[model samples]
Target: MVEGRPVGRVGDVDWLLTGSGDPVTVFAHGFGGGISDTRPLGSGVDGTRVFLSFRGHGGSGPLPPDWTYDTLADDVRQVADLHGATRAVGASLGAGALTRLVADEPERFERLVLFLPAVLDEPRPAEARGRFVALADALDADDEDRLASVVALEVPAEFSGSAAARTYVRQRTVALRAPGMREALRRLPALTAVPSADALRALRAPTSVIGCVGDPLHPASVAEALADAVPNAILHVYPQPGVLWNQRGDLRRRISEFLNSR
Candidate 1:
């Protein structure tokens, strides 16, 4: 079962630490997502894995009144330091937090994984901000159906009618109905993860950047740009957006291989 007891706060942020051994792998989930959402990729990996949710995210504390990607990186740093982790993994918004963390401290981590990164050095277009804003509005209104509708826009069209998609959207909608969720979605989409490409160029860790074609929310171009900008980064482009469903084994094996590389 995927569960964790509240073992108190780390760096004023709540998180769950699991596994054992050296080379601990810390996980940061996307916005409005719980650690369970990231466990699929981190499972069976070498060494220990610790998952940290941002101040307002996952099951963490209430969202701070004033915080950005850089501020959130402090939370990541605290968790990694406490565990003596040499590797870290992030998805979407978490990817943003990690990028900010590494940009400021290039050698903070020995290895890094950015899965389905949503943004890089710049803020996405105005149109791209609509979904998140819509979500925030829906959440403020306490409209579950509206929240589901906004999530549906993020899922691939081909899978929209499937049972898995319904369950996925439902789970997301429920998880997002938290105290500070609306405020987060409202402020985040407008913020940039890092100031410029120079932020990526300073990275000194061996990194893996993974993305897929069909996910408009997390574009492949952003992933490609991150790979190009980082000095020692490798890129992986999955053929479809539903990589967790279609490329599960391949991805699991790839993460293991990359994390275990000599």
Candidate 2:
């Protein structure tokens, strides 16, 4: 559907394209994020931006029963091939997939930026899994208040006290109302566990990591572990999620500088 390359089904997943230039960059969104979540990072970049909505996210199709990090990474690889993207950035679960992709096919990407990776060292707790299940239940029932309540529990203590943060959580949670969103949330924990830290040490691409404070689900330690494991990796830790909107400029500068340096 776009000018440069064929835009349609890649295996079973669908991708939306944006921007136009050389040396394409792909922006992969977090667990709850869709194409819109990628807009801020992709907008000012000086190249084509491919925003991939993973299976069951945004406009993409439902996830297969066997879906895992490898499946998601392969989907990203398909998009990278379609657009010839050598530089890419991803957040949370999206970042986990990108890490897996680079580990599997290092030649596919020249550089990468990982933000708030959800991949953790320990197995996901039953409490957290229960929270996601409850979120899906609330979403299935279309109970906005219940959905917000479940999400609020995960918000960092600092952000929970602020009105803007609550509003932002509500706004972000609305995306779960989309068709197939429940499947994505329910499967997220398993996906996060794959492409383990030991597996990521093999990645060769230069990478930069961004960590946010006060988010229990995406702790700063995960980012630190990744930066230490991957070759040629750097990290920047932000204060909290509430400042992310105003901090886009800093994020953009760092990602661009890192990608351009190589």
Candidate 3:
């Protein structure tokens, strides 16, 4: 059974746990996502899988007034330490947080799996950032129409064609209509300072990256760049468009193979 509780005051971060073993695998979801986003990953993996909701997302409390990658990483470490995590898998912003955690405390995580991580040398396109910011502002203003527009813009192009995507967007929009969402998005700018290519390359733990060919948020070239930088890092490219969050089977196969190899 998955247990939910508070690991720290930033918010009541719930830890979802399954299985029993030494090498606990912790699941970290992306921006605007929660522990439920990791349900597929947990189902795919065989051992202990712990899913955490980042500060301001899901059941976690609002993000600290001042948030940074270090703070996010520290939160992850605290939860991992509490659960004795031996391995970790993170997607997008979560991947950024895990990277910093492994770098700061190498002994804590035995292996790392990063999915469609967001690390761009240049700032995100002004138009895209503006759209997200506008949505956040609208949410703060309690403007439902503007908030829905923002959700539409945030949805990946690939998801546009799927019924699941439509349902997800509606559900997420409703969830974000609450008061704390704007504050959460306000804290997102801090996530822009992702680890440099050299820093990711220097990581000591065995690493693997999963890339989707057409995710605007996390371009495939970024994965290629990291694979080039890190020694022995495995890169798996999927033909599917958008992020790997929706591609459970492919991601599971690649991650399982990589972890077992180590």
Q: Indicate whether candidate 1 or candidate 3 has the larger TM-score.
A: 1
List candidate 1 segments past 4 Å from native.
Answer: 1-8
In the range 1-262, model 2's lDDT, one tens digit per residue, is 5343444567767777766778799888877777666767765677688888787675577777667787788778888888899899998778888877877676677788998786744545565567778998998888888898887775555667688777768767876776667876787665554435776666777889989876666777778888988888888989876335557788877777776674
Candidate 2 stretches with Cα past 4 Å from truth are 1-9, 125-130, 140-142, 152-171, 193-195
Q: By lDDT, is 2 or 3 better?
A: 2
lDDT of 1 at 169: 90
The CA lDDT of each predicted structure is: 0.82, 0.75, 0.69
Question: Which tens-of-lDDT digit does each residue in 1-262 have in candidate 1?
Answer: 2485444468667677777787799888888886787777787688788887778765567767677888778889998888898999998888988988998999989999988888887787566687778888898888878888888886777778899989889888877887777777878777878888687787879999999986767888889988898999999999888777678888878887898887
What is candidate 3's CA lDDT for residue 18? 67
- Model 3 C-alpha lDDT per residue in residues 1-262, reported as the tens digit of each score: 3344323332356566666675688888887777767657656565677788887776566667677778778768867878888888888778878866765565666788888776633345445456558878888787877777777755666567478767777777876765566776665654543456566555677788878775566777767776676565778878866444366686777776665554
**lDDT against true structure, model 1:** 0.82
- The number of clashing residue pairs in model 2 is 0
Choose the strongest candidate by TM-score.
1
TM-score of 2: 0.84
lDDT at position 49, candidate 2: 81
